[model samples]
Target: MSSVLITGASKGIGRAIAIELAGRGHRVIATARRPETLADLPVDQRLRLDVTDQESVDAAIREAGEIDVVVSNAGESVRAPLESVPLDEVARLFELNTLGALRVVQGVLPAMRERGSGRLVFVSSIQGRMVLPMIGPYGATKWALEALAETLAIETGHFGIQVSLVQPGAVSSGGGERAKVHLKDNDPYSALYQELPVLRGEVVTPEAVAATVADTIEQPEPPLRIPAGAPAKQVLEARKVAPEDKPFLAVPLNW
Candidate 1:
């Protein structure tokens, strides 16, 4: 059985993935900001990991040791237009969504390279490929993730390390509906956000994304990019075939 380590497993997609992988017989190591929050996860271990902290990341990886699959699933987003986004909030988003994953990959990759076999999966978003006005900061971070994952896949191929990017369309974590982050005065993209529709009825569940993640990880040669939802698939297809399409920009109201 392969050992799989997931970051941000306290709840949502990360929690679902942890549960599914554990059920599949993999030795699952789940980490979150608070270990107690993940006490109910059916995994081999639940760890306390604040992805923004270097020490926390280092300790978690050292403790998990010899992981066959590393899934970077931690992320946070502040919803606001480019003009309204606060500089500090933007930095924090990058710290969690992009750099946090990069740090985890850096910590785990050496061991994987030495073992000559491993998989690294990054949870990105459809926004990574397309730009939306208020979500520019969040989308910027995912774009960075895509760049990093693609580069790692090319660089680590000879070392028998596989890197894959999982781009999911909007997912309903339930908690997301209640998540409120601050936006600033300068963030003028409010009009754009107001124009976009919200998906009140059709949102992909965390469980669905988790199952897709499990399948992707188990593949012997997973592709560089895996779309985890129908919306994600559609956006990815459009990005690949028709670079000019911008339908996803109006996804705020409904995609």
Candidate 2:
């Protein structure tokens, strides 16, 4: 069985991935801010890892000496227009979504390179590719992650390490729930585009995304991008051959 390490495993997609992988007999090293929350899984070696902290990331890597797969699953969400967003919130979003994942990758790559056989999965989003409104910053970070994952795949392919990106269109998670709560706070451009309520229901359960991830992990040659839901699949396919003038919706319907 391959040894796997997944971040943000305390809840949501991260948690489901951990359970799925473990159920398949892979020895999983699950990391979360609150390790105790992972009590439901095989947790003899649960880890406390806040992705934003370099020291915590480094220590977690050190603890998981010979990893076969590393899933960069930690992230946060911030909903607001680009200009109206506070500087700190924007920074936090990137720090958690982009930099945190990068740090984890850097920490694990050395061992993967040494082993000459490893898999790296990035849990990105559909918003990474196309943009709507009130989600530019979030999408920007995912876009950056896409670039990073692609380059890493090329750089690490010769070493027998496979780098892949899994774009879950919209998985219902703690962060999403939190965003829903905040969505009604009345942001800058709320009144201007308030005719979209159907967009609000565009979310798939974490279990759905986890199933695709498990499939990708078992596939012989997984693609660089795997859209996770019907909406994401449609958007990705449409955008693939879409006309330049056509616009694709990337934000929630309520936004």
Candidate 3:
């Protein structure tokens, strides 16, 4: 069984994934920004890991020992029109959702490389494939993560490191839901936010996303991308049907 290290495993999808993997007999090292939050998790190890902090990540990596799989599941989202969203909020979102994932990846890659085998499962979103008006920043972060994970797939393939992006839509536990943040009350895009439908189809459970990730980790050679629920599958199809809706809807980018 692979020794799996998960970021943000204290609750929601990350928490569920840790439990599922541990139950399946993998040695699971569950981590969160606050180790205390991890006290209730049934896993092989619990450690403090703030993906946005290099020192915290380093400490966790060293403490966890040899890690065969790194699930970069720690992320936060902000809801707002791109124009009205505060720049500082955007920066913080990227710092955690984008750079935070990168920080963990960088911390673990050398060890995985030395061992010549590893798996990276990123808990991305269906929004990574398409954009909605109110979810610009959140989608941006996921899109960025998708790019980084894909690049790692290519760069690390020869070394036997597998990368899979598990894109789930509208997770049921409200994992990705965020309070709308605008710089002012008289925002121009208020109507747009009110009208746009962000959550479509059936909401996925944290366990469902966790199962998909567990599959990715356990597979001898998992696919480069996976949709964690029907909604996400629909999102991809929706994009294909309306390419003009997203002209540069090429194989790169995120929220």
Candidate 4:
């Protein structure tokens, strides 16, 4: 089995993946901003890794030693309208959800390049495919992440490095409470906030998402992008069937 490294593994999908992969006998190195949070996991190694900090990322990679697969799952969610969202908050979101993945990718890539084999799996969201009113900020991050992962797939193919984006729909991440809403009681976008949850599909467990990621890793030649749940697949299918000339606004809001 390959040596695997997962970020944001203290809880949620990352935590489930660590458990699943370890159960399958892969050497699992699970890391988070606080290594102490990972004490109960059955993985091979638990190290402190803050993806926002370059030094911390490098240190984790050094300690892990020759990782064969890197699952860049460290990310967060936010809810706000573009008109009222703070610029500083947007920047912080990008720093974690976007650049953080890049830092980890850059850190582990050299060894993979020299050894001529590795995999990079990024945990993206269905929002990357479609956008909701109050979720634009979060969608923006995943959309940008998809672009980077797609580009890396082309650029790193010859080096024997594979990149995949695992996009899951609504997850049971504490009833979506993980996403901090930036709006106030009398906010102008209150209507959107009230209606947002209605547009979501069935909520899947973290274990289901973990199963998809693990299945993707087992593929000798996995596809560049995978929609992990029924909700995720439905979103992608909707996008595919949409008319090219008509605006997204014109399309039915049946989703």
Between prediction 3 and prediction 4, which has the larger lDDT?
Answer: 4
For model 3, residues 1-255, the per-residue Cα lDDT tens digits are 989999989889999999999999999999998889999888989999999889999999999999999999998877777766789989998999999999999998998898898888899988787765667898899999999999999999888889999998877666545445564677776666555443344677999999999988888879988989777887787677874743533233233
> 90-200 in candidate 1: lDDT tens per residue?
898899999999999999888889989999999888878876556678889999999999999999999999988888877887544544445555545555555434522
Give the TM-scores of the predictions, in the order they appear: 0.90, 0.90, 0.92, 0.95
Error of 3 at 118 (Å): 0.5
Winner on lDDT between 1 and 2 is: 1
Global lDDT of model 1: 0.82
Candidate 4, residues 72-169, lDDT tens digits: the string is: 99988778889998888888889999999999999988889999999999999887777767778788988999999999999999999999999998
Candidate RMSDs in Å, in order, are: 2.8, 2.6, 3.7, 2.0
Scored by Cα lDDT, where does model 2 land? 0.80
Q: Scored by Cα lDDT, where does model 4 land? A: 0.88
Q: After superposition, how far is residue 242 of candidate 3 from its true place, in Å?
A: 2.7
Question: After aligning candidate 3 to the native by TM-score, how far in Å is the CA of 231 from where it should be?
Answer: 1.6
Best by TM-score: 4
> Which regions of candidate 1 deviate over 4 angstroms?
178-189, 198-202, 243-255
Which parts of model 3 are misplaced by more than 4 Å? 176-180, 196-199, 245-255
Q: If ranked by lDDT, best first, what sequence of candidates would result?
A: 4, 3, 1, 2
How high is the CA lDDT of each candidate model? 0.82, 0.80, 0.84, 0.88
Clashing pairs in 3: 138-255, 139-254, 139-255, 140-254, 140-255, 141-255, 142-255, 143-253, 143-254, 143-255
